[model samples]
Target: MHLHCYSWTGAGDDLRREGERRPPLPPGDLAAFRASPLPPMRTCDWLLKPATRIDTSPPTVTEAQTWLADRYGTAEPSFLHPADEARIGLDLRLKIAEESLAGGTDVLWGIWLKAGGFICLVVVCCSPNRHADYPCPCRLTSP
Candidate 1:
């Protein structure tokens, strides 16, 4: 499974002005970046070099929410919200709950803002499962 998140800093109007100053991303690398299966945060130079050149700080949940709200607006519903629990498919919720109890990995990636109006992209490659079940998909065993 994979998830993607994006965020920024400063007023919306400043983005266009700031963007003009930065070098553009290579046309070819966009696909590769998307295809890569959650590369480690430390390896985010590809993104940091161009789009988020100003900020080098790590991403935070608060900034992530702010970015989401800014771009998508608060009107649209979110499955992660507790009030929308009913909207979450029963099977998926069950799987998540079971996974929590049994232990499973979580991977995250995103871009976040810094103190000086710069943004940084961060990728949390993987959070290992504390108590995985037998026949774990993340690991291989000799027969």
Candidate 2:
């Protein structure tokens, strides 16, 4: 969906050429946030808002282990999946840690192996399968 508000028209867009700095954030939280090691966060301008969402169902720990090992070389037993709404994709960090292939890929792909070693590419997630959360126990539980 696209918004065709007056902002997209010539008049409002021209204001971009004369963009003004936004007022600084309120002091109460500003100092505390700035003191943190995390990257600075900022609000988006109304001129160009992002699409509502870019979601992928969280991958299973088993899948993450392979991708992480194939990339990070040390995903250890499994990833401690973050608990958050955005859940920023950590695949890029995995890439940085991996020894690159002879031919770099825009996207890394892989297959899932069955117990007998029969395998299939994970083209899409099939439901109602779901990954278990951390501290979930050493045993496997079918979703």
Top-lDDT candidate index: 1
lDDT of 1 by residue, 33-84 (tens): 3333323233322232223222222244334333433443332232234345
Question: TM-score of every model?
Answer: 0.21, 0.16
Candidate 1 has its poorest 10 consecutive residues by lDDT at: 124-133
Q: Judged by lDDT against the true structure, how good is candidate 1?
A: 0.31
Candidate 2 residue spans exceeding 4 A from truth: 1-57, 74-143
> Ten residues in a row with the worst lDDT in model 2?
1-10
Give the Cα-based TM-score of candidate 2 against the true structure.
0.16
The pairs that clash in candidate 2 are none
User: After best superposition, candidate 1 residue 141: deviation in angstroms?
Assistant: 43
